[model samples]
Target: MRAAAAALAAAVALTLAACGSDGPAAPAGGSGGGVTGDVTVFAAASLTESFNRLGEEFEAANPGTTVTFNFAGSSALATQITQGAPADVFAAASPATMQTVVDAGDADGAPTVFVKNQLVIAVPRGNPRGIAALGDLSKADLKVALCAEQVPCGAAASKALAAAGVKLTPVTLEQDVKAALQKVRLGEVDAALVYRTDARAAAAEVEGVEFPESAQAVNDYPIVVLKNAPNKAAAQAFLAFVQSARGRAVLGEAGFQVP
Candidate 1:
């Protein structure tokens, strides 16, 4: 009788547990949810890989949420956001670029600096040209690529070059960091000026040449939720996740400086 009663009690406990709020059922909008809805993020190209990874992690944590990123030059992204593109968040590679958004009254609040990146020369895996220093970029023979002067990476390159008193005549002015890096990968150019994080993330395809002058051109990455965000709650939640331990781990592993 005692054994039968104990078995009955165990079954009743299991039934109650299954019916509780902690059951396997999803929270809202389905069987999985913390925040649901799509979030569009306009970020700099340098944050492409890291932000994409972070987006996946955030979706897993928040569930029911979808992350869509528009990665390109910070200036371009800023222009797009101000031009009426519906974006939930904006993460720029440079503070100046971020201010463009805030000045336009498109940003929700003061942006937070999440990471910092420095410039580096991205060359082919073998670095066949044997480009050694900043001076080598102006050789006039090595097909070098540079970012468009208006972009953050280009601004940094300009500062670094000005400090060194060297002028680099590039074969192409890429629209974004990835485009510049592409010039090196496709053998279109011998080298390119890109963020160190970009080179590290693309280590499988390119090699980074560390020069001393890049120190003077470090750029900070700032993130903010837009004032007209499609999903303010989701955007804020995503921003917090990016500054969380997991996000920091991913960004640090990608070679970004923690802010």
Candidate 2:
């Protein structure tokens, strides 16, 4: 009887050990589903408004999870990410910028295109300068602000201008779309070439002018999870959330073309 009892106890111990070993594995392919933690996103300045809204929705959907963002020019953000910025995800205004991160071996996988944006002339609410088309921005009398050639918006502006055969000399070369738009909003410049979404975001202060040439320079926005993310699971979750139908709706409302 004693020997039988000892064997039964040993069996019970083995069963307990096996049960203890059955904890869930790390999220499959780091694609988060049951994750709970802080998720940090490094995104382009152009994504500020829409991303902020999405962050709120993401947090609401995942109790005990928080979403944080570092919004700046895509180039600047890319540089930071490559230099080891502690970001779980990176969303860029252009593929070129996203390539920087992928080239640095920091991105977990190929970036996915989430949306597209087109350039628009941001003029004061009343079109005070009588700007009507891309060529109008070239007028010597019109004070126009443009993004620096290094930024995505600036690059798109250059493409659109070339497509329209318009040679423009900007009064100011801002580093980001928001800065260029600010020049128009503050009356520092009569107009600026900015993203349609940005112009819409600042509709109270500026009006968007859609020029046909802008179609030639539509910018594709891409997003990816970082390979060295501290919260890989949460990062995956956030990325998936952004690609969901709800995410597309938010982007659509912000004047972005869902991909």
Prediction RMSDs, each to the true structure: 9.1, 10.9
Prediction 2 TM-score vs. true: 0.87
lDDT of 1 by residue, 119-175 (tens): 898998888888778888888678888999899999999999997888868888988
Give the distance in Å from residue 219's predicted Cα in candidate 1 to where it truly belongs: 0.3
After superposing candidate 1, which stretches have Cα over 4 Å from the reference?
1-19, 23-33
Cα lDDT listed for each candidate: 0.84, 0.87
**Which portions of model 2 miss their true places by more than 4 Å?**
1-32
Tens digits of lDDT, candidate 2, 163-237:
999997888898899999999888999999999999999999899999999999999999999999999988988
Candidate 2 weakest ten by summed lDDT: 23-32
Q: In candidate 2, which residue pairs get closer than 3 Å at backbone N, Cα or C atoms, i.e. clash?
A: none
Report residue 19 deviation for candidate 2 (angstroms): 22
Q: Candidate 2 lDDT (Cα, whole model)? A: 0.87
